[model samples]
Target: MHTRKEFLRNALVAGCAIPFISGKDFLAGARIDDFSFTSPFIRVGLRRTYPAFSFFATDSLGQGRLHLSPILTEPPRSKAFTARTYRDSISYFNSPEDIVADWQVKCEEKKIDLISRKPGAEPFEISFSRPQNHATVLGIMREGQRVLLPCILHLPGLGTFIIESRVPDATIFYDVTARESTGETPFVKLRFDGAGAKGTVKYSMRSVTLFPRKKKIHRIPLFDGYRRNFINIFQLNPRLGMLANSSSGDARASTLFLYAEVARVTPPLTKTFTAMDLIRDSLETYISGKQGYGHPGWSGNHESLDSRPSLIIAASYYIKSTSNREWAQKNYPAIKKWGEEMMRKDSTGNGLIEYGYSGNSGSWDSKIGPANWWHTIGFGHEDAYSNILCYRACSMMSDEKIFPQDEHTRACKAFAEKTKQHFFTNFYNPETGVLAGWKSGDGKLHDYYFTFVNSMAIHCGLVDKVKGKEILTKLLEKMKEVGFVDFKSGLPGNLIPIHPSDSGSKEGFQIYQNGGVSGCFAYYFIYALILCELYKPARELLLGMMDSYAKNEFEGKCPNTGMTRVWKTWNGECRGHEGFLADSYHALLVVEGVDPKIPFLNELVHFLNALTVS
Candidate 1:
């Protein structure tokens, strides 16, 4: 199982190593094991051996707590006799950074410098007795790609440390050693670094001196809260000729959304390029086929062909975020193709697009179905959400003149009309004001209400604002009736009450029956409500959702539901491998709404403050 924590660490440290593929190549020999720490050296041809770590089982709180077996790589048989080894000792951290080291780091304005002093082989006590204290060396690791170390420092009571380093697309390295553990005299070593590329190393004085240890091991939660949120933000650098992640399969449209988010705010970051520029470059990668459409991000994973909508939304956000006219012109063709081929109607009189493969229709799931699964038996159709998303995409395309003026406007309007006339007519029940999943030929509604449907509708702006509001109100009421809307506790996964419709069964909270209150629903629920302007209810629901996850009953992480594993109903236990997106997504909403000028900043502020306090 490729868990989020493990994947996150892999992305943080060595995302550059993985080969980017489109959605189709999901079944290729791309093993998740390639990301494991077992292979110490990620041989990118002549690339140097970079230090790396893996994430595994952790203790209680979420910290990097894995006993990574010493990483090793295959050696040529010719040099087998003189085998080289690689290993890393245990790591630890504290708030103010007090370990065992006679090192000092100073930070004023944006400049950061570090000075280290170590006696040659002699103990600190012996060296102190000498008139001229022993050997001392100082080095500097500056903002550019430079490292100056092994030097000395003659300074004052500088109780603070600052980190001044910048890299366009490079990794950083820092290591420290200390001797002298026993002390009520806080032997502090101030160190600072940003969330993106700041990698550092420190050893306790006791560990260095081989002194008696009080605790066998300890791992402090150094980076916590929302500061952790931006870890991925400032580091969204896609490698040339390669996709960054599954999401970056098409770097172009993807950057629209990514940069849109980044361009909205200012923070303590070093990178100079705006999010818009990155988005533009990403689009170029997609258009040039450097990102290879079909395996990971393009049309590879699942046959849904719905990534066009994601691409569309990303583009819309990018345009809205930066108002970049030139970028909109350069990458309009790919965006147009995504809008047309992915969602365009068939000229053969069929109700769907040509090669409208309803392969697996999920963003995260890796399952790939047939090129065309005859929807003879299912109630809900595959491309319903796709249609809505395409409509929005076309609307944005037209707004940006990505397509010819008349063509884009006509395309957008036609798709909107067809989506409503053909799809919504059957699935939506205006009487109940709910967009059911799909309508059965037997005239019965199947999957009458689904969070996926609701989320997509709200996200794509397909759901009518007023009707959607009423439906959401009823959904919340229904959720409360089923004991799934307890604000003091956690919210349910779906508001339809996944449990038995009977009142007696409704007493239990977080239980699945009608899709139950899931931690994963936390952000989706807030997103829907916020988009619909249901502030009070959205706020209440979000708090309850967070409280539930804090308990960890759902998953070791948060925002998951107990659906597929249990009786498709009843059990409330669930965990998500990719729910971190929920936090970021939710943060975007909470922060953006409080201040529309800045998307999801309140949440970002909260996350940063929590991290600082931690």
Candidate 2:
């Protein structure tokens, strides 16, 4: 282990690889099967014949630990493999790089350059070096349609690393994925695949650290549990800092709302990737007229109605977190244009955003259409979920730090006020003291007591505090009334059963999107409760959910059912098909201190007060 000064001084000497970081070395009982380097910052174990068997990290206090397995993969992704046949000695990097030459992976600023050779009469050459610490930089170089490049990086509470590179005339067949391990431990697989490509590719990793708070958070079983088996659902890129719909490849543009609002993510590795990169890419995508960053923009390529607003919020958070006015000023024109496009969705001039579909019962077409993120719930026409986001987008767009004091900003302010004023009348259910999920095109209210819809409205300040409290009270009552005590699994999407005719899929009640339990919206409910000063209920909700996270119940497929755990039945059946849903962790965001503009943030104070029992 090297110190901060040594890291900056001689991180690399000759061809030997070594890691120098902020703190001292702390290795007590770590089992090492191969040549390994260990320190408070990062640890790596490498074998002469194959890729690194272990890659891990720890915070300065040595409290938080991150363990990863860096494996090599080729096409078909049939399995992860390493170079078993190699001519080499167990020569370590002077510090910790260039393990045995002949084969090598270089972590550069712009790209991860990779080169491997077969040696015998031919000497097999390889290069493996750890990049900066706390970050995982990954990339895919594709000039055009010829390149089907794929790369993604993320850690539990830490964020993603970014890499953007270009190589002309080189067919690099490689991608990177952080596959969650099947066993109970946090032994995740980070694969950089270069299978049968003719040319060169990229593979590299570095470490960065976000030191946790000095004072321990108030004792809450959930936070400690979640910290143990943390699973990352946020899949980020230049285009969109999205959430994974499943294990890999599929991206959900709208689901990132929580990542932006709750996590308020900053860049983990600032040298090559920053949170602002997502904002820039979003502008580029909007300029190119892409409806949404996710190709599964199931609804007319626009993703869902929430996409634009979600992106807007994400960008706003970046600006808020960074206080980067210059970036905002430079991009305001495109930003303003997006605002205008979003407003145009209010074709009726009723001050509420509208959708293209009729949203009549059963109007949801799973393969191609839905008005919002909950694809199978038959939400359309006038949607509460969409409006809640639209309200937030307009409210944030009017910020002086974002848009200049122009007519566009004035319009945003006015629209936000109008939305706030009309929201209750349009969506609140007088009988239930809660809001409905949506208003159908035929002028009908579809009220299933959707937990997300009401919670979102309340937390976004669409309703007054008094009304918010009333709604939360009613929601809690309904949840208990329905015998929905399975908080360990997560709160149900709706307390009442989704109508058969309204479900997009044939899946019955208590299944995916049909009253299924998930953290997707549970966080909002708990936060709203805390905001309304209902502390006990909020604490209870949080503790219950923490039980699930500690057990790693949210992600990874179940051995028996073989179904994913992010979404489950009230009775604990695995109904979700996606192996993992990152948005499920959004429920834990209240402790992250959500957003500054919202009054609830002050109530949260910090992680310490987030779960204080009253």
Instruction: After the best TM-score superposition of candidate 1, give how far the Cα of residue 506 lies from its true spot, in angstroms.
Output: 24
| Residue 206 of model 1, lDDT score | 8
**TM-score of every candidate relative to the true structure:** 0.50, 0.71
lDDT of each: 0.35, 0.57
lDDT of candidate 1 over 177-202, digit per residue (tens): 12225422111122222222233322
Off by over 4 Å in 1: 1-271, 276-278, 290-302, 345-382, 400-406, 417-423, 430-433, 438-445, 455-461, 486-524, 530-533, 545-574, 577-587, 593-614
How many collisions per candidate? 46, 29
- For every candidate in turn, the CA RMSD to the true structure comes to 17.5, 10.7
